[model samples]
Target: MKLKLRIWRQSSADAKGRMVSYELDDVSEDASFLEMLDVLNERLIAEGDDPVAFDHDCREGICGACSLVIDGQPHGPQAATTTCQLHMRKFKDGDSIDIEPWRAGAFPVIKDLVVDRSAFDRIIQAGGYISAPTGTAPDAHAVPIPKQDADAAFSAAACIGCGACVAACPNGSGMLFMGAKVAHLGLTPQGQPERATRVLGMVAAHDEAGFGGCTNTGECAAACPKEIGLDVIGRLNADFRKAAIRAA
Candidate 1:
């Protein structure tokens, strides 16, 4: 298949960016989106031109590194799909595709399609873990977490922190990502001890990192590759309110 790509090009964080167009022929329908880019880079490199840069790892979609907005959709037009898992077949011949990095102030582009997502790491460090030590792996039935709570916790934990939530949000809020981390722990009995502090610290870090506040537009959950629900954000807000009151 033949295709046209309009990609954002920026050499550095401070460099100006613009869409540059290129055309390619003989693309395989089975080729994953990243593989298509690889083909384009190969041709550019063979001509001594700087290859387009994009983030990718574990192309099977486990790693959220393949962050991109394809044709105005995060991870292409497919619902609940990551860019690495998107296929050329999803497009038609002669289609013009616009590829851009995750657009959010908290996730500034480092170059080409890569953005600095260390803001997520900072939020995690703030309080995404249970500091209480479990010296060794416990018996499978030791804690006996309610199946309902366990399922909810597992669902929340599915979040891959891809920043698609932020990219899709009109306000650039990361509440979906932040809420997932909070709910993942909060739903589990082991996470109770730090529940209050976890919500407080993470929310503080989230704001400090320049992420916007959630306003219930629901775009974050819709764009989530993991299908993390806006319900997690509700849980986050509930926890935050309780935490704030407790602190007072």
Candidate 2:
């Protein structure tokens, strides 16, 4: 198949960016999106042109490092799919594809299709972990957790921190991301002790990192590659309210 790509090119964070078009011919329909880019980069190198830059760690879609806004949709037009998991077959021959990095004040452009997502790491560091004692390995059956709580925690833990939620939100909100982090731990026994403080700190860090506030538009949940639900956000709000009232 042949394809036309209109990709955003920025030399650096301080530099201006524009869409640069390139025509790709004989691209295999079954090739992964990143693989198609690899082919494009090889061609560019042969032509003595700078190759397009994008992030991809573990290209298996587990790492969430392959971030791309394809054709005005985060991770392409598919629901519950990351860019790395997207296949070229999703597009038709002679289709023009628009590719850009995640757009948000918190996620600054590094170069080409790569963006600095360390803001997410900062939010995680703020208190997204539990304070469990580290000693000898405890048996998995040592602590008996209720089935419902375990399921909820597992569901929330499915989030991969891909930033699709923020990219899809009109306000650039990170609520679904933050909510998943909060709920994943809050529903578990090991995470109970730090639940209140963790929610408070992560939310504060999210705001400090310049992530916009959640407006309940629900776009975040819709764009989530993992299909993490907005119910996590609802749970997070309740937890935050409880924390605030307790602090007062």
Candidate 3:
């Protein structure tokens, strides 16, 4: 396939950025999106031009590091697919693709398509884990957790922290991501001890990191590659209310 790519280019975090256009040809229909970009970069390098910089760790889509907004969509046109998994066949010949990094204050661009997502790491540090000694891995049936709770926890744990939720939200909120972490741990027995404090601390850290408040727009879930449901946000709110009341 022959394609035109209009990609965002920023020399540094403080540097001004703009869209630069390049023509890519001979892209295989089976090639993943990142592979297509790799072809483009090789051409530029061979031509003595600076290559486009984009984030990508695991091309298998498990890492969530391939954070690109393609043609105004967080991950691309496909539903529940990350940029790394999006195939060249999804586009037709002579297509013009616009690619940009996650646009949110909390995720400032470092250079080209890379953004500093360390804010997510900070939020996790605030309360995303059970600091208590877990001792050792217990038998699967040892802990008597309700099947429903276990399912919900597993669903919420699918969140990959890609920042797509924040990018898709009109208010630039990270509630869905934060809520997933909260629900994932709160529903599990191992996380019960820190449930209340976890919600409180994480919420505090989320706000401190400059993420906007969620207004229930549901864009986050729609853009989520893992399909994390909006119910986790409700659970987060409930837990926060109880935590606030207890601290009062």
Q: Where is the poorest 10-residue window by lDDT in model 2? A: 130-139
lDDT of 3: 0.94
lDDT of 2 by residue, 1-248 (tens): 99999999999999999999999999998999999999999999999999999999998878989899999899999888889889988989999999999999899999999999999999899989988678997999998999999999999999999999999899888999999999999998899898899999999999999999998998888888999999999999999999989988
lDDT of 3 at 205: 92
Scored by lDDT, model 1 comes in at 0.94
| lDDT of every model, 2 decimals | 0.94, 0.93, 0.94
As for candidate 2, its clashing pairs are none
Question: How far off is residue 107 in model 1, in Å?
Answer: 0.3
User: 155-199 in candidate 3: lDDT tens per residue?
Assistant: 999999999999999999999999999999999899989999999
RMSD (Cα, Å) for all candidates, in order, is 0.7, 0.7, 0.9
The TM-score measured for candidate 1 stands at: 0.99
Residue 2 of model 2, lDDT score: 96
Give the alpha carbon lDDT tens digit for every residue of 75-139 in model 1: 88999999999999999999999999999999999999999999999999999999766588888
